[model samples]
Target: MKVFEPVVRLMNRLKYAQKFIVIAVVFVLVIASVSFILMQRMNSEITEMEQRYEGASYNTALKDVLQQVQIHRGTSVQAWNGSEDAQSKLASIREQANRALHVLNEQHTKQTYPLHIDEELDAINEQWQAIAEKDRWQDRDELTTLHTNLTTFIIETMLTVSNESSLQLARSPASQNLIATLTKTMPSVTENAGNLRWLGASVLAKEGDMTAQERAHISEKFYLMIEEFATIDADLQRAFTDPDIQAAVQSTYEEATAANELYATMVEQLLNGETANLTSAAFFEAATNTINLQFDLYSTSLAHLTTLMEQQLSELKMNRIMLVLLETLIVLVAMYLFMGFYIGIKRSITTIEQAAISIAEGDLTTSIHLHTKDEMLEIEHAFNKMTTGLQSLVKEIGESSQYVTASSEELHVGVEETTKSIMHVAEMMSDVSEGANEQTARLQQSEDALQHMTNDVAQIVTNSEDVAQLALTTMTLAHDGNDVMQQSSTQMNTIQQSVETTQHMIEALHGRSEQITHILQLITGVAEQTNLLSLNASIEAARAGEYGKGFAVVANEVGKLAAEARNAAHEVGTLVQGIQKDTTTSVQLMGDVTTQVRTGMDLSTTTAQKFEQIVSSMEQLSEQINGIIVNSSQVASSTEQVVTAIDAMKVISTKNMAASTEVATATEQQNASMEEMAASATELATMSETLQTLIQRFKV
Candidate 1:
């Protein structure tokens, strides 16, 4: 029991296929075992029936032959009395007896009988041979004894066979008892009636030579015969149940009793020494005929009983045949159902295998359709789910990739335009610086010659006007720089919006990758379950012994397929992880790009403010120059003031130049970052394309 515990546990955990096979095998084995047992029982019954029939037939034929032999012996005894036709009748009887014996011998050789019965037959044959060789009545008494013993042996053998055959046919104890009584009583009745005839014949044949003692002895034998006949009649009344057999038995008893009464009367007279009035020959004749009549009636009853038993045996044989046929039909039907179940399972497994093959071949469009409501249906549902998830993820990646690519391109262009604008602003500031230095040189010359300042005042006013004109031109350039800054700011705003959009797309792609990972996990779980199921099936197939070898092979193949599916799922999972990592990185890059774009927008706005300040200062300087031109007398004082204003202008220009340089450096950094971003986006797009290509392998 302890050893079997693990086996029992294993069976309990068997998969659907293994469970199905076990059930089918057990059902078939049980049915086959039952069929085999039924067939064996049927064969046993048939053998018993055959034995009964053969035994009964042999007994009946042997009895008939023995009776014929007995009749022939009686004829030979009568032939010794010198009747005119007795000799020829005796010869004819002998020939008939010999033929009967010959037939019995032929039959005996063909059939099987008990050893005791064979010995009996051999004894009877020996007795008959001895009798045939005797030519005289010198040993008449011995012959009588021998004849009686032979008759008794034959009768006993017949009765024994009859009883055995009866027991075989009897279905109940009551029937057996009834048959036993009939067998004993009928043969006893026949033998006693024949004994009465022999006793009466002996009395009449030897009456004249009989002494007193011999006469008394004959009287005692007569009384004994009468008693035996009465016993037979009583037994018949008690045992016989059939109306026909009862009537026949009753008639036989009546005739035997009447003959016994007649013989008794004859014996009484002979014992009383009153034979003077008796016609012994006529009385003996009447007595012989009465006894013969009784024997015929008893024989008829026995024959009828034998016929009934034979008919029963025949019916039993037919019933057994029908029972065997029914069992055969049951076995055939069981086999048919077993085969049907086997075929159904095989076909289902085959379908599953085909579906696996399609999946392995990268056909994501192939749908697994099954009408069965078993384990295969569960697998189909899981597979469908996995494919659907994969398709959705791939589609999202593709859309996100295209969006990232476009955003990167837009950001790159914006960075280039901002850089060019900053460079142009730097060049304009350098020209303004050169013009301020020349204005300072002219102021220093005016201070050196105060006496000649009046003359130089006109030159200074002219220079001031020129300087004013230069300031006006510089202001125009500043306004142009401001406009460029404004355009740059707008482009930076556009880049920022694109970066935000790209960030959102990347975030979405990251989420999709996560979803793909989850789907891959589910697929992996299903594959593992399939592998376990296949393993269990293989175990059960091995337990099925020789019959399961093919099934084992199929199970092994299924296991391999499940393993391949698992490996595929793992591969998909790895790819999803890579996609997830890339999406995460892309998201981070988009974030950085968005921050850079915002910074560029702020720088452009600051540059625009500085340009506006420059323009205001230029307007003031131009107004101051106009005052100097109108009042040339204060030229010397205005010169110093003009020089100071020029210095302030130079300082503002230097600040503007520094600001432009910072803007240019920022733009250059932004451009480099955009280039990096563009490269990252390209890589992301390539990854997305790869993912899409991988997803196309599976059929939804």
Candidate 2:
């Protein structure tokens, strides 16, 4: 199972030259890809948004300009006074209308529509300007036709260029609401425009000087037309409230009605012979103000629509930018965690795995050579300690073997000597028996006269009785002496047999000691080998210089232990030699005693039958004494074995202590190295944090 930990570690340990380059390349590729896609989307959105905003702006501007032109045109037509200033006013109206037409053209072009409607509107505006420039009011019919034509142009050009029919269909619910607003406001505009046109027509019809009767007739006719216009104003007012036409139609009618009423009043006065001197300047001024009032309504409506459009645009832009920034921040945060924090964890895991594998292979020296001070380093330190312990245990076993071998040799020699001594003692008993026999023979010859005396006294009474008692006393003393000699021979033979049993026990103990010695030797050899290994490790540590000083000390300690083991071996050898010498001397003495005992035993057996009662008692005593001797021999053998085993154990324990010390030293060294690595890793992590912070400064 290839988990991320090991893989990440391997990846991190890869040459920094390659690692950094890869990181840089990857970062660049990722950032470039993200930035490119984001930029493209943003650009497309910006383009769409810009088009909507600009379209709304142009439409609003066009509406305002058109309203201004309509107002001025109405004012010029409304002039009731017969003043030349009417011509100048009409010229100004034409100029304003032309400007409105130009704005409409620009709006259409910006919207990417055909230029057809704009061209037609421009022509209409030119026609109105041409009509205004002509000064021929004397032909009343012509002047009225000119006003009629101008009204046609306003209606036709506006409807054609603005495409009001299509605009009504295109209107959203909000746009429809704006259109409905015209119901309340356009009536006044219509009334004012209508009144102005009526007044101008009446003034034209009544032009030129005339006799009283002629003037009255012409004036009355003009009055009748003016009255008609006044009625039209009332109709216009009704129309303003009409569900269909509303304010636009109503205002046109009202303008005509007002202009007409003024014209009728002037005509009536003139016809009735009352000279009411009306001037063109005053009429124009009143008409202009009325038109301006109408324009103000349209301007206010346009302003409301513009404000709505601008507000919507502003909100849309603000929300879009905020959303973009918020999403970007979230994305950037995720990226930071993935690349910085998560990556750091992965690197640490990799380093820990590497250290673990190294340690698992009997390499107590395996260290999480990481600069990181995290949990991984702690684990490495623990591993190092475990390995050190193993090394030490192995080293101690080697140091204690020599003593066990020496003790075994000593036991063997002791056993052989004791067996020989038993045989010698048995032979010595035979020699003692022969000496007793010779003494007994001499006593037999000396007792012959006493025996003869005792026989003579047996017949002779009191004197003879004294002689027999003396012979009896001498024979009792001789028999008691023979019994003492036999007892001495049997005791010597028993002692020799006991020595032989001791020798057999010693031999068994020797075998056990040899086994122990062999084991000790193995342990000592292992310890020596371990010491050498430690020394080599120390050398390596020393080569590491300042960093390895602690390790070097541990190595020195191990080397010292090796030397100590050698000294111990020498001492054990000497002790063994002494034991061997003592056992050899004991074996020789035992051998001589065993031979004598055997000879004595043979001699005693021959005499044993001659003195059955005494031999039986002596044999019982010898059997009891032999058991005592065997038990004593066993005790001595056991003691020697115990001593030897203890010496072996002492040597082993000393070696173990030394090994433990070495282990502790190695552990300490490993800990030191791990600590350094941990510190370095910690610093590296800190630096990475700083680097990440610095990297974030670039606007993505």
Q: Supply every candidate's count of residue pairs whose N, Cα or C atoms clash at under 3 angstroms.
A: 6, 67
lDDT of 2 by residue, 232-278 (tens): 34433443443434433344435534654554465455455444465
Candidates' C-alpha lDDT: 0.54, 0.45
* Model 1 per-residue lDDT at 509: 48
RMSD after CA superposition, every candidate: 13.6, 21.1
RMSD, model 2, all Cα superposed?
21.1
**Worst 10-residue lDDT window, candidate 2:** 691-700
Question: Local error of candidate 2 at 171, Å?
Answer: 16
